[model samples]
Target: MRILRTDIQILRAIAVLSVLVFHFDLPGLQKGFLGVDIFFVISGYLMSRVIIDEMDAGRFSPAAFYFRRARRLLPAAMAMFAVVTAVVPFALTMGALHDYVQQLLGALAFGANLVLWAQSGYFDGQATLKPLLHTWSLALEEQYYFVLPLALALIGRRWRAAGLVGLLVASLLACQWWLRRDPSGAFYLLPTRAWELLLGSVCALPGLSARLPHREGRSSIGFDSGWLWLPIMAWCLLRGVDSVHPRTDALLVCLSTAGLILQPSAMLQSTRPWMRPLQWIGDVSYSLYLVHWPLIALAKNIWLQKVPDTVLWALLGLSFVLAQLSYQHVEQRYRNLPTPRALLRQMVWLLVPLLLAMGALALHMHMHNHSQAGGVAQGQQPVYGFDARCDQEGDFEPLPACMNTPRPHTMVWGDSYAMHLIPALQASPPDGGVIQATRSACGPSLDMARQSPQDPPDRGQRCIQFNRSVLAYLRQHPEIDVVVLSGRWQYYLDDPVVDARGRFIHPGQHEIAASFARVVQQLKAMHKRVVLVSPPVLLGPDVDLGLCGQRAAQGLLTVMRTLQTHCAFERSLWETRQAKVNAMLTDAGQLADIDMIALDAFNCDDRHCVTVMDGVPLYRDFGHFSQDGARLLGLRMKLGQKLRASAR
Candidate 1:
């Protein structure tokens, strides 16, 4: 109804800045994700106000409203999409480019959130490589736009206020429930995000706005009471806890923002000298938001070859310049053009860019696919395979040749990370030694576990069956001399312990020690040499080798070193868990009379765990070793000598 207010502009700046700092890996900005919630609320309030005003005057036009939205959202999005599509082929590996192309198509179709949700559920590292990872917000907003108008039309004038409020509350509750059950899905999908916008929708209703007092001076609330809400909001932003439960924190931020919007006081207003630039940035906020991320990613990549802080700042400055110019020349001109005719022109303009983007994305995918096919033909490395049993059971089966062949002199088996070690194993094969393996998504343990928190009862049955099949395979493979067991083990250490029925047991009480000990005992009875490989040190929960390389190039040596040190220190948790399991193994080993190889010292020194050893990353992610890292580790352990001698 009104052009953007100074306060609203100020809020926009806050939102964008929070996100920028978060993306830059600045401390205390981890909660910057809340900025998307702020944007959703603002979008709801503004769009609802316009729709209500137009509908009351009997001049509402869905076609015109949607056209305006498309013009506002699609052009810059397609621009970013086009740029990313063109650059990805040259910048990313073939496997990475294929994933990016899929993400691009999903973003273009406004279903990026769903694609991301499904991908996240699969436990793949592909999520980190997606350039359009931010499109989940746009998808949520588009989904809201699709439903909100028809909802307003149906309720009519008399009952609309109560109906809308009721719907908003119901949706909010539903989202809360769903988040607790399937947080990964809730985090990325549209339905779980609808309530945040609806809260803003309810606030925009005519009578609701009128009910609040329009005081000339600030309402008589004291300084303590007035300022308390700020820290309460800030605390929610700073605290980083496990998001296992439904997020009540988002609602807290949303409600606090609603309060600030409804009753702006002197304190809430931005009058400080510093606030001016942020406010200015807020003015062209939409363009700034669209352009910043891809630029940052590109800068990170280009400078990764040889980075300096000056270069980073220069790239940031370049991005700002490009954003401002785009805002002034492109966005401003189109947004202010006359209606209907402007709408038609905007549609044509938007469609051309989208089509071009789609074309570029397709080309990128084609090249990537061809590259991967060639790599496979040349026997570079195979990252994926199909298991016959997995196909029959409607699950990801074990690789067909993963474990069924005649037992080799040595065998390495576990997850994808372990699979990546195949190249290194092949490179340094012991004379007269043969190695075979089975690798899959689940950890090396054959214990029954759920794929997801929302997994049905059938999953338990499936896991039990799978474990039995694995046990039988192991029983039949007695000739496999050295069983090198490895996996992304750290992921399992903190998992909630459960009983056979999958009911949670008390913390620090449920034990898997005996079960693990028995598996070791079984292997020992078969006269298989057991080498329990420990997890590598991790820098963070998720790892991006490209990002790490960029940081290293930038001469952020302290940061990189600290990350490696922290990861090495954190590996003690795994060691502690291993101590308990190993004690059990020690007792079992005495009775079975077998040798247990401990390889924890392979990647660690007294005070640090080095991610880069001899100029190679020890890990692809936080805990799993990269191919190069694994090879280096294998070499350090004298794997070839030990395996060949054991076979003899």
Candidate 2:
């Protein structure tokens, strides 16, 4: 009744291997994420073929289709989830456990994609820490399955082609629009992704393959363009791991995959000896995909360093072996039950119970973390800024400084760095209360063209509008003086260097200086006193002290901290890394006649720059201060005295 294509199996192998290689950090497989796009196309084709064939035969059942999917996908997925849940208490810190619990809940409910979409940018530094992040693809596929059958049935035998074409066109358009506007939504949601799957469905249409001429050397079905597909794969690989993304950029890969499936030639179908291993991996690919990421995450969490090649190879071997075991035992064992009713019963008995248990565990961990956090005094919470605008970046809304300020006098402006200064400014308000006009990545730099890729999309535009509004507010009220400018100035200098005169210099230090100059000039034109605050000393991996402190302070799941040592690095390391940016800031201050405040000058010694001082951790993470750390910094810097003098 059903014909299995060896070529399709080969493609499956290719897809899985690419993904594995990418996740394993194998060099040159940067575009290995294209494997997922390949999978989407394959899924679309295979599911459509099966559904269409059944419908034509007058034997199709939507209930039976979904039952088959649940049986095939859920068993292995749930098993992997169970293992992750068990590993959490042992491997994850309480804070991490709380976060993972939320992800786990999302995974179980077929909403992991949505959860990840909302949590943070997919390419964020924290993405590697999430074991369930790979599940977003699975969630996306499952959501597709939910609606496909009904849509196909509604199209009927007569209009299936037209309907699928319309669907594909609409979805592709939506994906293009959304990718530019809201990349995360386009990436994770089914509506934007439906077209890729439907492309495969289009390939499976009854007479689609009849059009391609058969070639003798390239097997029975002779569409021999094997070399053509290479360029497509190469284009995808060129994108690399950091740049792996979807939408229009993914169209080429998806179309190529569809072309391969639709026109399988001898070039594609040859079952050579070297290809056997790939076919084998293909057989167990789903299982491998499920198990590999969590293993990598667990290893990273424990080691807290880059995994060595030797260990990575060993992990790869282990993942393959485990995948074989899972494929044979769990996936195959449960994939075929006696009947639909029996399968449903097993799903209810086994799958439902597992999901419920994980959900409950996640809920319990989340509540425990919240309760522990509740015990700390509210004032001790880290302050970035009091204004709602400070936390969120958006279009400007004019508001009086007195809205959040007890006495509106000084204003803090910059990026997230400015937010950290809020504590000190609040501790010692200016003649009027200190107000904050800040965005997370919105530096005070007037140059809108130099926005960071790490920043939110439209950040450049938002920064421009925000700066314009702030300048307008300053002009409107001469009462608000003493503008304290603070941000991670070093961040902007992370690009290719240019010279002081804006000439192309090697790793140039001048752009940051120029940016600072522009910002200071604008504020100075308004006759506002500009105070430049130096960035806090940045640290390495040891800076994730909050999680360590949480474990030590609150023994969640019996995690005990034996030592009082804080995360710190040598003063030399800090000076070496920050010297250029520091020089730029100091120069900017001198040229602009602005008062520059150096926190590092007081906090660091020649020996080592401690992350903690007198039992209070100076940093919550790598750069930002914790609430207690901020309070202590305010006192140590004598920010109140400085602000009072500056105001005078």
Candidate 3:
């Protein structure tokens, strides 16, 4: 007989609720993300038990296992995707709509992890807008389900524990090693996460958890009470969240969850009225989890501003109602089908139409996008850089557009900050135009490479090599008499750096400032005039750069207050943040004859630094200028006349 464990239901409730709260940005449970870790452990334990028992019974079938999973997970998920697809054109921006289409396809293929891995940006702070972002976990779990059975079958029951143990150690060790280097890879991939599942697999190894004391087997009633604290304690320890992820905190949380799983149900299954609500929440947790994020994402997308706490409360209540309806209707309806054939027929009937509808919608949107962008030339990025492909991260050969009259006398160099300057440079065309030599993330440093949290261990070497390549280009091109340097200077100042000689380069303006000075001196030795463009103003993560201008332009009546959108900020705040960097730049300027451009001085006024001009957004994102923005700034700041004079 199948045992109906109320404890599993309760644990499910906690896991799903924590995830919901974390998504909603509720107070107190800051590390509610640990709930997903707990779920992984529980899922591994149950699946392992089923695979082992069925294999021993000689009835294990991959098709049957997959069909059962499909019946359990797919119906409500596809329905949500259908509705979200319908909502896409109305609520999201052009870029977001494009991303939505890509994500929708990834979700259908159960490859959201791979898509998101590729799309992972500089900061990864835009989680609220991506409605399907939570599906990465689902993708990882499905991949595990596909692989685990094969590995277990190969090893057989006799060596099950030994096999799981070996795999667990390998995965855990890899996770720890990669966390410091390629964080997103360690985070979103199956290999690193297999250990958490294997932990549960180890628990289900027949004789392992069987030796542990259960609630029903306990001598004293008080001993069973300690198990209750396990879940609570796990939630508390998860406060560090991803900072301590795939490490000790994760292990402890999984162990606590396993203990709760191993504990007998009799103590918690008592006819206690209070426990009914939690158990019910747990029963509907899967449905609730599927429905919550899209609701939150929809409000953020359409409103184009920060959602107030009051609206969030309403959304929370609405989420539960929607989840209950979905659970009662979609989840139960699909689950109650009499046979696999009946379930397959139901899946085809329900899924095919919705899938077709989403596909059609995506096609319409793609055609519309092509029409919108058809005016641009065939081989162009259309905005940030005239010929951005000339950069080190790109083709490394200057296109006609990247230079003036194809015989360039000026060189543009740095990181993405330099790319953002392309239009601004083009707007203020220098004498003989500009030749570009920029790299992404790899700043214009002589001997050291700046390291971000996302970079691999060898990223330092690659960056150093890229800088050397830039130097080689500069050496070969004696006609490039002027060099323009720009980058997100504060990023390099804030993050750690490594030198070409494999030495640790301390992160701060001191080392980077000195490095820039050396670069300037070397350029000056080549008789090239150097222009250093300082950091631009940033509105930080809280301000949605893409949405800020749109909201301001629409002049929407916000739920919070009249001036709800902050399209601009006080210059003082920016000045204060960049003081050290500005000081470093000043010191570097004194070392050689150079032109220093304070971007804030060009873009900001006495009171404010604005991101929008003439009702159009200048910035594509938080700090990178849109094409329109660069052009406007180029003209407004009189960059053309200034560059021409500076070249002389």
**Model 1: runs farther than 4 Å from truth?**
1-3, 126-128, 210-228, 240-246, 270-274, 299-315, 340-385, 388-484, 491-515, 522-648
Give the TM-score comparing model 2 with the true structure, all chains together: 0.87
Error of 3 at 317 (Å): 2.4
Q: Model 1: number of clashes? A: 1
Judging by lDDT against the true structure, name the best candidate: 3
Per-model CA lDDT versus the true structure:
0.58, 0.70, 0.71
Give lDDT: candidate 3, residue 177. Answer: 91
* Candidate 3: tens digits of C-alpha lDDT, residues 113-161: 8888876755232657788888888888888888989999899878888
Off by over 4 Å in 2: 1-3, 121-125, 209-223, 238-244, 344-384, 392-395, 399-403, 427-431, 453-458, 495-507, 540-565, 601-603, 612-620, 635-638, 644-648
What stretches of model 3 exceed 4 Å from their correct place? Answer: 1-3, 123-125, 211-238, 241-244, 263-271, 302-305, 352-360, 363-408, 423-433, 445-454, 457-477, 492-515, 550-593, 598-616, 631-641
TM-score of each: 0.70, 0.87, 0.82
Which pairs, if any, clash in model 1? 390-397
User: Which candidate comes out best when scored by TM-score?
Assistant: 2
Candidate 2: tens digits of C-alpha lDDT, residues 1-648 = 234676777788888888888889888766788889899999988888888889999999887788788788988988888777866666665545656777888987898988888776511325676778899999988988888888988898899999999999999888777766677788888999889999998998998842333232452434476666756766775563244257434788888888777667455566688877877877898999999999888765554435667878999999998899889988888877858777667655556656666776667565655764432223223455565445655644445531355446678777778887777656654456677777766667655423443333455666667677777778887877778888776655664222223333333466567667787888878878878888887643333444443333334332113223444557777777678777888777776777777787656777676655665545555567666667778877778568557531
Clashes of 2: 12
- For model 2, the local distance difference test gives 0.70
Backbone Cα, N, C clashes tallied per candidate: 1, 12, 1
